[model samples]
Target: MKVLEKQARTVDEAVQLALEELGVSRDEVEVEVIDEGNKGILSFLSKPTKVKVTVKPKPEEVAVGFLNGLLHFIDKNAKVKCLPEDEILKLEIESEDAGILIGKRGSTLDALQYLTSLVVNKNCEEFVRIVLDAENYREKREDTLEHLALKIADKVKETKKSIMLEPMYPNERRIIHTTLQKDRKIVTKSVGKEPYRRVIISLK
Candidate 1:
């Protein structure tokens, strides 16, 4: 949260100054009148009114708050931890049944991550990427995909036939393409449109 203190002849004026500096609306901030100046004798020794204004918390703070409410609504006994690095927010879910959160092939986790990104970036000036994981599921899934890609490439080399894998999201397809890029006997390409797009491994 960003905080600022300002002083003017009136509390409203001080608040206005704070709002302009923070570049936020009145409803988006908390304002406290530190001192309502008194009109001294002849107004010659009067002090200016002072106020302290605080802007709303950062995106990470907002995201954590939202996740807490969401977890409670789902009745899931889990804890969310956020780590911000550069332009990406890494969120991890800790729970005894973490696999349930990951869902089949990490579809559920991807959906949750998308929603969280929307919530965090709504009305934000600069968008930040959100990466969600549960019990290191993302890393494990990447490793699995890389292994599958190599295995498929070997099969393609031996049979001299192209094999089209099941439909996958773009990120998953990228993993397959990247994993086989350096193989001399095989190549990879993505086929079809979104939601049904898949990777095809074939002999070079």
Candidate 2:
């Protein structure tokens, strides 16, 4: 993508010149005026206009570039080999005794993945959906969540009431809600505040 600007007698003329220079149609470029031309008493004596023109990339290219950067960063800094799948990216990191990356209950790894996603989205000219995981961590996490949901749902059935599960991030909560969506005897709902919010399972 490239941006170009120039001053001309009128906004329309300025945009036209930009399109000509960019070798693109008028619809392909975005034009914004930094300074509108001042029209004098005589039409021929109008002040020059200043406008900015930008060219954008196609959505697919943007998504590829974003994933490329993510792969590079993981390989260079984390010393991990990452491969981009059709809809997700996978990483392999050697197991360490300290397990610093996993943090407390894999919080650090989760935070790293989130930050990587932010960087990819920031650099791309178009929106791209990226999912990062280490050694199928997301799949394992999903299974764990399903088990927990079933356990809580059983408790709810036995007690004939609701059971409040500990707070989780939006993604984790979604997993819980989705995993139990088909169960006719149990229902899931979110409660409390963000960062401290939790999921409640009740008998349906």
Candidate 3:
């Protein structure tokens, strides 16, 4: 949050000055009239209106700032672009070392997205969903998960034994579940607690 004080001939003028200086819209800030100016007797003595304005940084700005600092801390150079689509903010990171940022199974990227969302919606009145991706990692990961699900389902059918996959996040588990939902030969069920929960594939 940033605070600024400005004075003009009227309260509205003072507020406008503060808004211009802060580079934010009226709804993004809080304005308080510090002193309502008075035209003294006979107009000999006059006072300028004063206002105090407090501005909150927009969500996109916050997301960019956070990603920049994070990349710097990791000693990695990446280009981050923030795109606002309706109520969702899509953050795309492009870099030659995208693999490093993505980490194994995109766990690092997921962590970064989670932290970014927390920072962006910290003081917001309405929460916005943040979607973060690096070099199309999400789509690739989804494809890999769907393929693995089918492979595992085939193994389950042959061995007549239930196979429990490695633990995965809910989103990944959902991909597996949805991919095999229509298969009449096998069934998928999620088991265990989060961060350790996995999908169980068994022959029908």
Best by lDDT: 3
lDDT of 3 by residue, 76-166 (tens): 6787999899889999998888888898899999999999999999989999899999989999999999999999998998899999999
lDDT of 1 by residue, 1-204 (tens): 699999999999999999998899997888888999976787789889999999977788888888878877664688899988887889888888877778899998898888888999986778878898888998998999999999888888888899999999888999999888988888788889989998989988
Off by over 4 Å in 1: 1-54
Clashes of each: 0, 0, 0
Alpha carbon lDDT of each predicted model: 0.87, 0.73, 0.91
lDDT of 3 at 68: 90
Q: What's the CA RMSD for each of the models?
A: 5.6, 6.4, 3.2
What's the distance in Å from true for residue 117, model 2?
A: 1.4
How far is 19's C-alpha from truth in model 3 (Å)? 5.5
Find the candidate with the highest TM-score and give its number: 3
Question: TM-scores for all candidates?
Answer: 0.77, 0.59, 0.80
Runs with alpha carbons beyond 4 Å of true place in candidate 2: 1-78, 90-92, 95-98
* Superposition TM-score, candidate 1 onto the true structure: 0.77
